[model samples]
Target: MRYSILTLATQALQKQQRWPQIIAPEKLKPHYDIIIVGAGGHGLATAYYLSHNHDINDVLVIDSSWIGGGNTARNTTIVRSDYLLPASFALKNFALQLWDSLSQALNFNLMYSPRGYLDLAHSDGELEHFMLRANAMCLGGASASILTNSQIAEKIPALNLDQQSRFPIRGALFQAEGGVVRHDAVAWGFARKSSEKGVHIQQNCAVNKLLTSNGRISGVSTHRGKISANSVLVAAAGGSERLMANAGVPLPMEPINVQAFVTEPIKPVLDHVVNYNAGLSYLSQSDKGELVMGGATDGYLSTARRGSFARLEDTMMRAAQIFPFISNLRLMRHWSGTADIPMDGNAIVGRTEIENLFVNCGWGYAGFKATPAVGWKLAELIADGKLPEMLKPFALSRFTDGALIDDAGIGPYPWLH
Candidate 1:
């Protein structure tokens, strides 16, 4: 039997089927200074920042399964800040800064490769949009270099240089800070270090409900028991909606399944992290020398994270277009993970209706790149009673406050998924 290797998630109905453990009522903690209800990258990262930055160590990082096993481990693992918004740039900047220093911070070799990221353009308007975004990046103090087709060819000679195709590579806006990380290592490192610092890293603990008191956040009821808290931060990506509904504040979220596959270990043919500039497709290479490739969800809604036959067909067509040698690669493994899509293709990182309740979700497919920043500001929000400058704009009230943070300007479809 061909066994699937996707694991590392504790609570991501986004991809794997993780069963929440059944707690027997007595094993719960009666109270904690803070309780973060998600053990994914965002949740665990939040816990790390809370303990390390905010000195809130009497905390717990509980997952339905295990830390970083969710979206954190299942990504194509490209980190970039080529977004078209100010807020995104700021958050990404912080995350990039953290990634640059993550090896030391987590005390583990994360295998972070600054191999560069490229957004290929196919037409004049597409090229124009790239420049506009590049200009936006310049204003944000981020180095976004615009490379011509010739420079692109020189930087990546493996691409099919033919000028005619459905989506041809015209030019690219390369971000030097952008790269790939070993997703599982980053997660395990954070979990390892944070546990050493005395934060209870509980696996197999799934939160079943959010206990409320007098119209404020109180605690979480888990399968292992209950942990009361002065504040709660919900960073569950795929499980965000279901958990929020327990608190009576349902943020608009659609669980979309994104599929990714790694080819049988091939000699490195693709160099940089290849980005689908026209849309949401992106490809990269693993340290083991596998040609890892993936793209957007099929613009449909489902909690299921199974790979569809259609996605394999769609991505293979695009891959062959970029590098004809990709045709010789064999499919080694295939799996799909969950992504949360809000009405707008952006993240929600602020207050919910419940006073002590907060959110760091709806990241769509782009949250992994902003992990460190999200963890920092979310820890601040959980520590201080106010929103920080970086996370202030992405508040949940945006939808009702007549404000929206639609970065890429992709409408409700979340094509960036």
Candidate 2:
């Protein structure tokens, strides 16, 4: 199976169409060089880099449930690095470069097709933001372009080019490197490869509390037993605060459930991934030609993935507005995933007040796009015990220091999930 997230995340287990890999129980040791909590893409990728790049093989990964059972596998696969701001641009560009080499680096088929992604500019502000991002990405060696209405009309002929049709179909910013990949393949590719390299991926192992002594993190108390380690990386997505709270490291994050759904497989259409900035929604035609649409943050304090039918209704109505042709497509399946929504739109990735406990959460909806850079940088921090200059700015203390990355870069709001 190919790992399909825009970034190649070596997975821990794969649930495929047939012959799925089993997630079995495993006992945790009392000690390890490092222990990474939450066996999602970020944790697994960190473990992979720690073993491969830093040669630290005594690393263990613990997940609350089966791997990829979090937001890691639930995102609508869209990849781009054309960010308006500098920091988001830097991280995304770095991730794009790593994505370019992911297939070869993982020695597997990522099915990474850079078939170009388009961001529709409905209003003047949206247009301005796209133009600024186009320039930023261009300077960063990305093949990004600002396309006029005529050009958009030429590419997507089915779209309503008439004025006053909600969006009016204004100019669009096109990033040729922006594309979609198979999300599931990425998780499995990373997990299988990393597990083979001797990294222990323990699924269904929920870390209940952290064990610390004299202001230093030493181990973790889980559902099964306790495990000791020198360094502990809490890569948990929605469960970030629950685990880190025990260590006195609080993240300004609340796990909000984001829902998405797909239509039944139809004939191949909507070749390119389309995102309407004005409507704040995105949809991509999957390999099976199913229109996979996802938008809007949902559920403020709910942990259960109970997606509201109203969300499905609202999103479907919005989809019909964006692509009038999709109104006829029948709904197939709907699901929701938890998002570690930070107060600021940016992610936290660095050491916290707790001595050896690290964090890599608050991805919102765009973390899948930055997995490669995150894994590489997080590995460096874990192995060397120091945060790099770029990642240092996104520390957990940003909320208190007021140095938060309040970048509305790709998100809908400046301070929302």
Candidate 3:
């Protein structure tokens, strides 16, 4: 059912008991043209675009848990495309363009707000780097500007800009089109639209093993039953490594825990998403008035979705150095999510050695922003059997060829990415 004022009023008059389910809990089909693993934003979006754009409706999306129950629901929603690399900027900028009109396309309210994003620089060297990045972003058709220290102070009066601080404010790279979106709404909107278009979404269905016939994918053995598919796409986020490994494909990525916390709702103060270069922390004020914040990944790698107090303390200390008022607020809650960080700090997308099986993973911390582009590209690859030029840079062969697309330019260190 389309959500609108008339539907809401009708439901209210009926005592709100007669409302349609967002997505039908359909039974597992015996066969499909394509099967996508993980019902998060990426997989659901892929299914949606496959049916809506490519006219391929015989698709099935299977997940172990409820939709959006994994990293999709645990992200601090920030979207931008101010990257130093050409391919990264293009993909993220494309996703941002999709986010701009996603609500209208899906006929669902996604709550996407394009309220600017600012990355702070603590020194002259950092400012110089940002100036170069801003130029590159503008050349690539993305809006970016350099803001001086005085301009930053004028924009954010509550920020601590004293020289006495450990990391004094210098300047920043600002993107007027960067912003955030409602994370859960993105998943639900895609799922609802895809289900309406004759796609099957099966929840609580775990893939036990991958079935291959003559070195090509034939089907998948799930908890529910065996399902056949001509093509299989693995868009699982943290579970990508294991899912691929089960299919005899080893990935050079590791799962790491990332944590985020929020403060009690207060009057609106922060007007834009803020990132501190030296502190390794980023924050933005949610529409509900809570101060949503997060920090760097843990030093070690693990799939456990819980962080140590030491990391939390370090993040709080750095946040206080930038926003002094944080000390007065009470912590509401904190949570963690698992991310698959590639060795070169870049995403891995495209075909694997196994023909008929495609993988889209290694997104690390940027998967939320790249959802739409990843889906669009993966759908194109599956439907046409040809990789797009934009995604060729991220193919698995890049690692073997030593043509890594390291966005940070920090070499092949996974943690730094």
TM-score of each: 0.90, 0.90, 0.98
Tens digits of lDDT, candidate 1, 1-417:
111233334335455455322211222357777778787788878888888998888777777886667888888888988888788788997788789989877866788898999988888888898899999988888889889988988878888868877777778889988999888777777776666666776777888988888999889888766788888888888787888986899887788878888889877766798876555557888878888888778668867777677877888878888888888878898888778988887888988888888888998777888887898888888887778999888988888876778765665556443
- Number of the top TM-score candidate: 3
Candidate 2 vs candidate 3, lDDT winner: 3
Segments of candidate 2 deviating more than 4 angstroms: 1-27, 409-417
Q: Model 1, clash count?
A: 9
Model 2 lDDT, residue 128, Cα: 84
The Cα error of candidate 2 at residue 102, in Å, is 1.0
Give candidate 3 misplaced runs (Cα > 4 Å).
Answer: none
- Estimate candidate 3's alpha-carbon lDDT, on a 0 to 1 scale: 0.89
- On residues 1-417, what C-alpha lDDT tens digit does candidate 2 reach at each position? 333563233332443335334322364667888999988878888887888899988889988888777777898988888776677888888888888878777866778888788888887777887888788888877878999989887777766667878767678999888888677667666777777677888888789998999999989998687899989999888788887876788778776778888899987767787887654678888888888888877735566878777667777776777688888878898889777778777888888887788899888778888887888899998898878766877888877887767775334242345
In candidate 1, list every pair of residues with a backbone clash: 8-69, 9-69, 9-70, 10-65, 10-66, 14-338, 23-223, 28-225, 28-226
What's the lDDT for all of these models?
0.80, 0.79, 0.89
Which ranking of candidates, highest TM-score first? 3, 1, 2
